[model samples]
Target: MEIKIKNLTKIYKNIKVLDNVSLEIHNGVFGLLGENGAGKTTLMEIISTLLPFDDGEIEVAGLNVKKEPLKVCEILGYLPQKFDFFPKVTLEESFDYLCKLKGMNNSESRKQEINLRLQEVGLLSEQKKYIQELSGGMKQRFGIAQALIGNPKIILIDEPTVGLDPHERISFRNLITRISRDKIILLSTHIVQDIASTCKNLMVLQKGKVNYFGSTIDLINKVRGKVWLYNILDDEIPHVDLFVSLQDKGSSIEIRYIADNPLQGSISTEPTLEDAYIYINRKELTV
Candidate 1:
């Protein structure tokens, strides 16, 4: 499935949260990378048809979101950042209930489909477990399972791994990558590593505008030669301006930084995804 968002704009008070944003997304995972309030959620809501836009158009699978909202909703699955389920309901029962609500009849074929979806999310073994009994990652997987009930053409997942631990985060990312085949998976997250590892294409939003939108490798290449690494004693920490990150060594710190010119005794280093994000935003703000 494909989503075409053309000149989409949304206004609150007197400000435009989504300022004439346009994007074309096809099958596979497409990430929206930005900080909170950068209009990621606003744009997602508009595309999902949960909120109205003041201008422009959005089409999903050839149907206009505004003119044929119900048609769009039929093929759309959305997992917001936060959602709640019946705490006492078992995983199987929860999926059953959600499927019924989505108009799936209580038939043998429907039951089997539910089983298949749960298995795809690796939650079939936990089908009898209560919602409260599942870990954070499992709960998120369950969320995705429900979203897959009708095998929707497009799925929108917002900040799916924020509170997860490192292991859980990796597991969730892998799950997303596995299920993204043959569908449009629009993922939104502020975490750079999440995009770096899971998404091949990404858009960076700043102040409701697209700062960079293309393949992940091209984004990283933007600041390739401007990154450097410097070894410094603790006393020199306060003097560095473009320090991006630091690693603690026995007697010194290894600092990765960005600069327009090289520093004395510093080694040129390859730019990371985080470095590219920082560099892009810094340039946008300075301009």
Candidate 2:
């Protein structure tokens, strides 16, 4: 399956929420990354047929998005940033409802399909439990489960790990990767590491424009030899104009930062995906 967008544009309140964006997404995990208000969600909505674009064209499986929306929906699945099932409803019942919505009304077949989706998401054992009883990670996985009921060729997940703990976050990323074969999974998130760990190809949006779009390795290479590390006292830390993240030791703080010219006594370090993201997001500032 493929999604092709050509010079797509969208406006809200006279502001271009998405400005002349173009991308080609294929069968794999493609990432949409940006900070708040950078148009990630808006673009996702447009592709998912929830919102219409003002200009350009979008084609999913050779069907024009604006003209054949119903056909487009038939092959697309989406897990929005926030969603909820019936609080008192059992997980199995929730799947049954969603499957029926997709026109799979046969009870026996739906039951089998529901079990397969739950097992794919590692929630098979929890299907009899009420929706409200699952943990945050389990809920997000359930969201993916419901999305997959119709065997969609494309899946869109927006910020699926926002409130998850570190372990759950990693687990969720792994789940996305596991089920990504032969399908287009568009993972949108403001969190840098989520993109780093899950996506092989990514587009970084800044202020409604494509700041960087290419392979994740290429993006990481943008800031090679530009990352540095040093130690500073927690109470005596200096204000840095760069995107600096700090790790704490017993008595001092170990800081890793990206800069064109690192401070004296700083050790040059290999850049990670996060270092590159911070650099690109703040590129105009450093230059």
Clashes of each: 0, 0
Residue 192 Cα positional deviation in candidate 2, in Å, after optimal superposition: 1.1
Candidate 2 regions exceeding 4 Å error are 233-241, 283-287
- Which 10-residue span in candidate 1 carries the lowest summed lDDT? 278-287
Candidate lDDT (C-alpha), each: 0.87, 0.89
Return the top candidate by TM-score: 1
* Alpha-carbon TM-score of each model against the true structure: 0.94, 0.92
Worst 10 residues of 2 by lDDT: 278-287
| lDDT tens digits by residue: candidate 2, 111-190 | 89999999999999998999889888899999998889889999999999999999999999999999899999999999
Which lDDT tens digits does candidate 1 get at residues 5-115? 898889998999988888888899999999889999888888888999899988899999999998888898988886558899999888888888777886786799789
Off by over 4 Å in 1: 238-241, 283-287
Clashing pairs in 2: none
